[model samples]
Target: MDHAPQLIQERSAPPATLVIFGASGDLTRRKLLPAVDNLARHGRLPDQFALVGVARTPMSDEQFAESALGGKSLLDKRQLAGGVRYVAGGYDDPETYKRLAETLDELDAVRGTSGNRLFYLSTPAGAFEPVINGLAGAGLNQATETSFARLVIEKPYGRDLATARELDGVVHGAFEEHQVFRIDHYLGKDTVQNVLALRFANSIFQPIWDRSWIDHVQITVAETLGVGTRGGFYEGAGAMRDIVQNHVLQVLALALMEPPVSFEGENLRNEKVKLLQAIRLPTDRDVSEAAVRGQYTRGGTREELMAGYREEVGVDPLSRTETYAAMRLNVDNWRWAGVPFYVRTGKRLPARLTEVALQFQRPPHLPIPADQLTELDADALILRIQPNEGISLRFGAKVPGHSFRVRTASMNFSYDQTFVEESPEAYERLLLDALIGDASLFIRSDEVQQSWRIVDPIIEHWERDRSPIPSYEAASWGPTDADRLIGRNGRKWRNAS
Candidate 1:
C-alpha cells in the first residue's frame, strides 16, 4: 500500500483585469504590485491578464509602470508592467468612474480580459462608499452573463461594529455577498492555513483537541519595529482595532473552528462564522478583568534609543492609544468550553513573531516520582506563523543521565528545511485567490460582524474610562498588567524567544 502524498495542482486564474483604486498608496507599492508580479512569474496569472491603476495622482501609463516596477529589471515584472494602465481621478467623482469604465473596456479589447473585473479598494476607508457608488453609477458592478465582477476591500473594515455594518450595507449595495471579498491578509499566510490542515487532516490530534485534553491556546502577533511614520494612522487605530479585531480574531476562529464538510469557500467561511459566534462576548466586568492595554515607552538599548508612542510624529503628547493589547477570550461551545484563548499583539516588542500555541493538559497521573518530574513541562503544540515559520511540539522527555529526571524537549519542523518551494507572501496568495474567485481565505460578512460584536463592548468600556493607559518598555514583552491579565487565570504570556 502506497502512503505517499499526492500532488494537487492549483488552476491558474482566468483572464481578468484587476483595477486598484489606491495605486499610489504605500500598500500598492510594497505589496499589491509586487504580489501581482510574483503571480505572473509563477505562471499563476492568466496570459490575458491586465492591470488598471486608479489614483488621484495624475500620471501616464508609462510613468505608473515605472513607479510600480521601482526600477526592478526583472523580465516578468517588466512584462507585467507592459500591460499596466493608469487612470487619474478622484474616488468620489462620478467622472472618475466614467473614465475607469472606459479604461476597463479598452483593456478588454486590447488585453483580452473578457470583461471579467476585480475591483480592489486599497484607498482610504472614507473612499470605500464613494468608490462603490461610483462603480454602481458607471454600471461597472453589473457583470455580463459570461463574466464575473468582484470587489476586494482592505481592512480597518470599519471603526467599530456599527460602522462595519454600515460599510457592509454600502458594499452590498453595489455587489452581492459572493462578489465581495473582505481581504484579511493573515488568512493567506501558509502557517495560518496550516491550522485547518493540521487539525482536520491528522487523525491523531482530533480526539484530544477539545477541552478534555487541551488546557488553553495562545495567539501572539508581536512586532519589533515601532509605528514610525504610520503613527498618524496608528493613532486612530490602536492595537485592538488594527490587529485584534481582524487578524488576531481571524486566526482564533481558524484554530477553534469545526471541521468543514469541504474546503469550498462558503463551507469554510460558514464554519469560521459559527466558531466566532460561539465566542463569549465581554461584558463590563469581563473587560475590566480579562483585558489589558499599554503604550510603548522609550526603553531600548542606549545605542538604539527609541521614541515613546506619545513622542512619535503626528501623535498627541497625551495620547491614550494603546500600542499593545492583551485579552483572554472564551468559546462557549462544547469543544472549547472552559478553555481560555489568550491573544496579544504589540509593536516594538522583544521579537517579531506570530504564532498560535496550544498547551495540553498535564497527565492526570504520572508513574514517576513527583521530584523526578519537577522539571517537566506541559506538552504544547505550537504553530509558528511568521519569522521562522514552522511547527514545534514540546514535551517532557527523560534526561540522558542515571537519574530519572525529565525535561522539556522539542520536535521541530521548519518550512524552509522541509519544503524546497518557498511560501508565497500573504498578499500574493490572497491576490491570486481573489483573482481565481476563491473566497475561502477571504472574510465573510457574518465573520466580520461577529468579530466586531466580540470586541465592541471592550472598546466601549475602555473609551468610557479616562484612566491613563499602562506603559511598557519599548523592547519588553508588555506591561506588567498584561502579565496580570493572563496571570489571573494561572497562565502567562508565552515569550517569543
Candidate 2:
C-alpha cells in the first residue's frame, strides 16, 4: 500500500491589493469572493491585504461589499469591507484606468499594503485586450524592486489557434511573460497534483509507468447539468474548445510528463511542454477514425423532463454545436510509444465526475483455469479528481471461500480519511499561488500555444467534414458512437458509475 502524503502548514501571502475587473460578474460572487473569504478564515491572508473592484456599473464600496459578501454579522461584514474599494467606468476608458491606479496607490498607504498589485481579469473574453491595454496605458503592468505586479487571466483563451497567438502577442506587449498568470483551476485540485506526488515520490509506481507495463489511459470529465442560461456562450464554444482544449489537455500533460529535475516553476513546466510536443497531431484520416462528437436529446418522464441542446434558451434550433466530444491521442515518444490516451468530456451526463484511469497490460500467463477467473478485470489505477477525492487500485484476488476463484477488488485511499482539515478549493490555492508569484501551477505562454496547435486541426477537420453530431439521452454517459470509437480497438470506457 502507498503511504499517505505528508500535510504541510499554510503560509500567509505577501501584502498586496487584488484588483478585479469584473467584480459584478457571476464568477466574482460564486468563486473569487468566496475563495478570498475562505483564505481569510484559514488565516492564510496577509494582514495588509486589500481588494479593489473595478466595473462599469456604478456602485459605492459599501454596496459592492454587501452584494459580494452579504448575510454576515455587522462586525464580520465590516472587517472584510474595511479593505475593499470600488471604481466605476467603461472598460476601454483611459480615465477609469487612471482612477484604478490612484486607488491602489491610496490603499498602499492606508492599508500598509505596498504597491504590490495582482490584477484579475474576470470579465468576458472580449474585454481581455481592452482591459490589458488600459492597464498598460496607466503604467500598472510594470514591476519594481520592492513591489511586484502580476496579471491573472481566465480561460477559453481564444476561439482557435490563430486567435490564441494574436491574444498572446497583445498580452505580451503589456506584461512580460514572467508577470502573466494564465489560471486553470483544475490544476489546483488536491487529487490532480497528487498524481505527480504519486509517481515521483513513490518507488513502486515509477518503475512501471512507461509503455512496457501500461496498456492505455482514459480521462473523462462529465457533467450532470446542461447549459441552462449560458447556451449562447456554449454555442460558440463546443466541448473541444471549452474543456478539451485547456482543462483536459492540461490533465493529460500532468499524467504523462517526464519527471522534472526540480519542482521549480520553470523546471516542471518544461517537462510538460515536452510531453505535449510529443503527442502525434492527428491527420485528416486519423481525425475521422479517432474523433467522435455529439449533442444531447430530451429524456426522463414528462414531470421530470430534460431539455435538449436545441431547446435550451438562446440556442439556435438548427445549431451544429457539440456538447460532447471524445478523441483518441498518442504520444510518439519512447516512454509512451504505441499507448493511446483517450479523453472525453460532455454535459448532462449520468454523473459529475473527473478522473484518469490507467489500465495495465494483462498478465502474460495465468496458472489458474479460465473458468475459475471469469470475474477478473484488467488491473487499473484510478485517480478520482472530485466529489470524493481518492486513489483506488483495482486488482484480481482469490475469493475467500473456495477453489482459487479470482475476483476484482479495490484498495482505496481517501483524502478525507487521511487528512483532518478539508482541502482548499481550487480557486483558493490558485489565488494564493498567484499572489505569492509561484507560477508552477499556472500555464505558460508556449504551453498554451502548443495545446492550441494540437487542437486546431481537429476543429478544422470537424468543420470541413460537417459530420452529423450524434445524440444521446440527457442522462446517458454519451453517444453510442463514442463507445464504438474505443470499442473498435477492443477496449471500452471505465464504468465511472
Q: Pick the lDDT winner.
A: 2
Candidate 1: TM-score? 0.97
Off by over 4 Å in 2: 1-9, 72-75, 78-81
> With candidate 2 superimposed using the best TM-score fit, by how many Å does residue 91's alpha carbon deviate from the native?
0.6
lDDT of each prediction vs. the true structure?
0.90, 0.91
16-117: candidate 2 lDDT, tens digit per residue: 999999998999888998888888877777778898899999999889877766853324654455888999999999999999998999999989889999
Q: What would the TM-scores of all predictions be?
A: 0.97, 0.96
lDDT of 2 at 374: 88
> What tens digits encode model 1's per-residue C-alpha lDDT throughout 1-497?
98999899976889999999999999998899888878877778876888889999989998998887765533546556457889998888989888888888888888889999999999889999999999999999997789999999999899998999999999999899999999999998898999988999999999999999999999999999999998899999999999999999999988899989999999999999999989988889779888999999998988999889888998989999989999999999999999999999999999999999999998988899988887778999999999788999999999999888998999999999999988899999999889888999999999999989988898899889898889999999999998888888687778966
Measured with C-alpha atoms, the lDDT of residue 89 in candidate 2 is 95
Task: Tell me the spans in candidate 1 whose CA falls farther than 4 Å from its real position.
Answer: 1-7, 73-78
